[model samples]
Structures are given as C-alpha cells and as structure tokens.
Target: MPHTKFPQIIVFDVNETLLDITTLEPLFDRVFSDRRILREWFAQLILYSQTMTLSGIYIPFGDLGVGTLRMVADIHQVTIEESDIAELKERMSTMPAHPDVIPALTRLRDAGLRLVTLTNSASGASPTPMDKAGLSHFFERTFSVETTSKFKPSPETYHLVARELSVETSDLCLVACHLWDTIGAQAAGCHGAFLTRYGNAMLPAPGVPVPDLVASELTVLADQIIGRQ
Candidate 1:
C-alpha cells in the first residue's frame, strides 16, 4: 500500500518492535517454569506503567519491570530472588534487534528520513537498550518517557517528541507494534504506522484513528515509505 505522506521524523518504539525480546525465553523458563510467563510479565509491566500514569504516580520503567516480574511470580506462587531480578535486567539491557530492523532503518535513513527512538525506559539507566542492541547508530536521537514522567499511549508522551524536535505533531510519525501506542499518536495529531508483528493486530474499533500505514514487518513499511518519496 502507498503511504499518504512521509513523515519528517520517524519515531520508533524500542522494545518488541525493534528488539527481539524472545531471547529471554530461557530465563523465563528457568524462573517461571512456564516460558509463557514472559508474555504475562511484559503485559503486566505495560499495564502497571499505564496504571501508574493514570493514578498520577510515576516510576522508572526498569523499576516497574522488576516489580511486575515479582508480581507475576507471586501470582504463580514462585519465589523470586534478587539474583533472578539482576539476571533479568542484565539480559533486558542487551537484547538483539529484529533481523529486519537494521535494513529498514537504513532504507529510511538513505531516503533522508530522520529516524529516532522513543521508549518507555527511564533516563539514567546504565546502558540504553538501543545502544546495547547495537542499533543506536541508526537513530538521530532517542527519547524516553521518563523525561516527561509519563508512560506512552499518553498524549503528553507523544507531544513531547514533537516538542523536542521543534516540529508540529503532524510532521511526526510513530511506528510501533502496539495498537494503543499508534492510536495515542494519532489522537495527539501525529501520524502513526503499525508494524503488525507476530501476535500483534490492529484494533477493530470503528472510531479509532487507523494507522497511516500497516505492514507485517519493518522492511515492508520502509519500502512503502520510500516508494512514497
């Protein structure tokens, strides 16, 4: 499909959209016995982040991650030790990028699109995950929701990116695997592209702002965007 318009700045969501977090399956299996708990843990991490935002409480994403892991462990009657938390954090900081990420990012950058990252990770973390993933060179900047003390899917988080870039919200496009994130960007008057990676799908709500582009992978989306140019 053709893009309606190309964005001046393409903002990326770091976690699963770009990085392959499946590498942690072994850790999850060792800790939770059921590797599926990794999915549950991540889902809870996002849920608690949003809940904290809605409740006017703000905590670093890393803190929320560890806390959510403990919560998930308790729910499953598993005992979680500090070592387990440390190990998880260590692995999280160094996830590898999805194989398609670097190529797609290069394609967009070669087309003169400004690329950047916007993640819910906190500022002052030892090593930003993108940098550890070796994908930092592809971006012009990396933003964290911690800077605004708000989690993503919040209008303020999306607005912060536009503000930092000194551009109108309409000139920014958020590319993410999360439908709520794209919906939030569109609601904030920015454009959005959805990467329909495995286990991710667009929302079926009639009135929600549909993404400007939707593709099965980042390379496909990049191709469409480049074609528009």
Candidate 2:
C-alpha cells in the first residue's frame, strides 16, 4: 500500500502476530504474583533464542521457553514449581488466535494471495499452536526455524521459506507485529508489513529500512493487501 509491489506469499509470524500471547498473563500472575512479568518472560525467551542462534547453538524453542521461564524466575528471585512450568507450556500451546486473525486470513486467502506462517517454534509439533487455535485451515502451510537450525533475524530462517516454496525471497512478504521480525525478513530481501499491535511500534533507524506497510489492525492490513491486488 506504500506504492510497493505485491508479494506472492504472505508469511505470518505466529506468536503475538496471529495468536494472543497476553492470554498467558494469568499464569504469570499466579507464578510471580504480578501478571506483567509475562512480557519480561517472553522478551527473555526471544533474547536467548537469538543469542543461542548467534552462538551457533540450536535449542528447540519449546525447551528454550521453559528454560527462559526458569531464568526469569531466578532473576526475580521468584520460585516457580514444575507444575507452574507445565502449566506455562500448556498455556503456551493453548493460546488463542487474536480475534481479528480469522477474518483477515480469510480475506487474504479469498483474494487469492498465498498464505503461510513462519514461526520460531517447531513447524509441526503434535497439535502446534496454529492447530490448537483453529487457525491452521487458513494457511496453505506453516513453517518453523527448526528446519534451518537457526532462529529468526538470522537470514537463513527466511531463506528456508523461499527455498521450500520454490520462490525468490523477493516474492515473499513477512507480516509481523515485531519490528525485529519484520526487519529480519526485509534484510533477507523480502517485503515487510508491520502490524502495530499493542505493546509494539516502529523504531526508525538508519541503514535499516522501515517496514513497507504499517497498520494497527490485521483487518486494515488485509484490506491494504487486497487493495494492492
């Protein structure tokens, strides 16, 4: 919508972008006596996932999520039980798709744009988050960094999608709520659409391009894409 060429595939970032991670706040409220720790815990999970990737180390995202929860608990000097960790894992897998997800996805698919998801989490766990949230039907495929053995913001992850889809990187567009995720795809030579969800916004910087399109609502983003068609 910013006078840009339309991409052949729209690759979605699953967590937070498609699904609502904030639903896990009650778990944090129970574990740390403050629900806001949810944000810190997720931030640590992302930080360490990328850290491990940069160090040439590979750890499954689910495992990293568990360890991150423990690390954050330690940082806050809050004791977390195995039950809590189990509950956290359960909640993570069971998080709901954001209310706008289905309609936007439906519109995009109906408009004949290819749709898929790329997540840092495993591509196909037994009942992956997409499956659990009932959003899998909207996507032609779902992808994960597992195949590349590299977490995102590392170009290899986005490259994997292009390879698997047999398309040039330029034919793909990464639609995401996180600036880091969008920037990573842009660096990999793909278009980026930033969904400015709550708790997220653009941070302009030199030498790094801004997202090709920015919209707060997924529906609006969908409309923009459809308009381009």
Candidate 3:
C-alpha cells in the first residue's frame, strides 16, 4: 500500500474511478459498434460540458447523458424511442462499482475518515451513478461542478468542492484517476493522489509530487490511509 499522512477529509472523483462506466462499452458496441461512433459520443459529451461551462448553462448530467445518446443515435443513423431512452437511462442509472471500490470505502468508513464525492456530473437529478452503485452510503457528501457552472481543471470547480465541504482547500485531499484532475486540485491548494490505473503518463504538471502516493486500486489506497494511522 502507498502512504500519505492521514487526511481529515477525502474527496473522490466519481465516474471512471469508483463506478465502472466501461460496462456500457459492450452494450454500446452491440448498438452502435463502430469505434468512430463511440468516440463521437465521448467527444460530444466533453463538448457539451465545455459549452455549458462557457455559456453559463447548467443542464443536469442525466439530461446530458440522454441528449448525448440521442446525438449518437443520430450520428449512427439509428432511431430510438422514448422507451429506448428510458431503458438507456436505466442501464446508466445502475452503474456497477469497480471491484476494488466497496472494500476500500468500507475500510475508510470504518476508520472514521470523512469521505465525499466531487464530480463534474450535474446535481439534483436522479441519484448519481455512484449512489446507484451502493457506495453513496459511504460518503458524507456528494458535490458536482454543475453547482458552480464550471467543469474541472478549473480552480473554481475545486474551490467549490472545498466550499461545499466547508474545509480549507489544503485540508482536503483529492483522489482521482486522471492527472489533469490531480494537477487541478494541487493548483487549487488541495493535496492530491493519482490512482495511476495503468501507469498513464502525467501531463505537464511539474511539482505535483508524482501523485504524492500512487495506487492501482482503491483497496490499496484504503490500506495507505490505514497505514498512515
């Protein structure tokens, strides 16, 4: 297990880390199959997020999901019914937690660590995919950049999470699978840990402490937290 001084509060990035959205890849291949189509959907998702951030528009991530799905359908020249949309949402609504997620969160909760989630997903809609994954019970709070009308990699987004948790940014640690996110947190004055899922190369962030500590799985991170104590 890696090591870090214990943190009073830990803020996690949702989506790719805790909840495995890759489950959709198979379903997507069956429907749209083409790699180009999948890339298009992902690209549009990021485009829409940037659009919302720049235009001061705030649409729930759920709505964005549905809309992006429809856009992909259009791109693939396929048609979807309201029922299809509903079914797609149902599929996403119950995202599966990664194998390492629950055990790690269980340990963190048992250790009395304050766990919270900070995501770029929209809020006040259906429960987050994480909540649906049964990990919501482990977190003390769930926050989204939608509340601040900004996406991450922006200091404002990190600051918003700290503000919502009522912790000084330095008092919190940001755990994420993406280097951009870890760098953003550090720039925003929070400590960071990068879950280097596959030894991905870090982007251009110097002085980032090479992630402070690295873990391939959340369970290892939990052990690190415990070891620190």
Candidate 4:
C-alpha cells in the first residue's frame, strides 16, 4: 500500500474478521427464539463492555455473557440452567474460521509477517477458538483484553493490542470487518484494513482513510497487506 513502511506486526480482530460467528447464530436463535431478542443480546454485550471500560468496572467477558443471558432470560421469564451456559461457552471454542482465512493467513505467515490476534472476548475464553480452528500456529500471540476491560472502538483496546505485541503503534496493522474498529485502530495510530465480507456500506469518515485496504475475501486482503498480487 503506497510503498509506505509496512507494519512489523499484523493484528486481527477475532469475532467477525478472522472467525465467522454465523455458525453461532443458529444456536443463539435456538436458545432465544426472537430475532429482536438476539439483537438486544449483542447490543447489550457491547454496551456493557463500554460501560465496564468507561465506569472502571471490569468483569470477565464470559461472566458478562452469562449475566447478559440471565438478563435476557429474566425478561423472557425463562429459567436457564448453569449447564446450558456451559454449553454456550463450549460452542465459542468450536466456531470455525472463514473459508478463505486459513490459506490467506498461511500466506502471510509464510511471508514472515508476525501475526497476532486481539479480541474483546474475555480471559475465561482465551484462544480456544483459534486453537480449535488450527489458527493458533499462525499467530505468535493471542490477546483477550478482558485485562483492559474494554471493547473495540475504544482507543484503549487498540492501544492495548499494540502494547502487548511490543510494537510501535505505527508498526502495527489492524484488520477487521467493522468500521468503528478501523477508526479506533487508526486513532490509536495503527494502519487499518476493512474486511467487508458481505459488501456492507462504508460509514463516511473524513480525511483519515476508511481502510488502507478493503476486500470481500481474506486472501485478497492479505495480498494487498503484503504488497503481493
């Protein structure tokens, strides 16, 4: 990209960018039938993540999910057992990566790019999904900022990633599917790529580029990031 100094470390946002969460949707729907209810669950999850960060109240991301589910269950007047919660946690460890992802990551790793994963997912659920998808080998490290108690779109989360990777903010690249995430990374001084897997509309952001790279597939995005075809 523009022959600028490329980042020494490439950091990825896990949930939507690296690992596809679509498989977990069916399980969520089965547990909470209403689509609107599912939407609220996700909404509150982000809300609480920010709330925890802003208010200086940190909770383990897994515990936060359990609490969010309890809130949903209470509203629906249904009682959920602890075993059901454990099952949901188990599923997080099983969600697979996108079809194009492994080969793309392999290419980057083979090219000698240092890879790492940064996620807002809690410490209780650290790196299991990457391990399950066989992606753990591609990354030199995996970070769950349950330690920071913040989610993406927060400068703290982005900065935490760079700090943990022991790379300069300018020497770290952040690739993700969300616009807010790219903005946060850029704000935190990282080069950014928007992984638009579904061709979603780009939210307008002035001056600062929306994404240094944009691609519908991870393979193409990897090429651009590595200055390949």
Model 2 C-alpha lDDT per residue in residues 100-210, reported as the tens digit of each score: 999999999998999988999876556878888999888888888998899998999999999999998888999999999999999899889999998898886777779
lDDT of 1: 0.87
Clashes of each: 0, 0, 0, 0
Give the per-residue lDDT digits (tens) of candidate 4, residues 1-229: 2435878588998876877666656656666775356556656776887788778788777678779878878888877788768876777668789998999999898888989888888644445778888788898887777656676677877788777766678888888887767878888888888889753447875675677788888999998988932
Greater lDDT among 3 and 4 belongs to: 4
TM-score of each model, paired residue for residue: 0.95, 0.96, 0.80, 0.84
Q: Give the per-residue lDDT digits (tens) of candidate 3, residues 80-116.
A: 6787677666776677988998898889888888999
lDDT values for all models? 0.87, 0.90, 0.75, 0.77
Cα lDDT, model 4, residue 209: 60
Task: Work out candidate 2's RMSD over C-alphas.
Answer: 1.8
Arranged by TM-score with the best first, the candidates are 2, 1, 4, 3
Error of 1 at 65 (Å): 0.5
For model 3, the local distance difference test gives 0.75
Candidate 1 lDDT by residue in tens digits, 1-229: 2335667689999999999888888889999788888888888998999999999999999999999998998999999999999899888888999999999998999889999888998765546778787888889888999888999999999889899989878888899999989998888888888999877897798898889889998999998867755
Whole-model alpha-carbon lDDT for candidate 2: 0.90
Give me the displacement of residue 19 in model 3, in angstroms: 0.9
Q: So what's the TM-score on candidate 2? A: 0.96
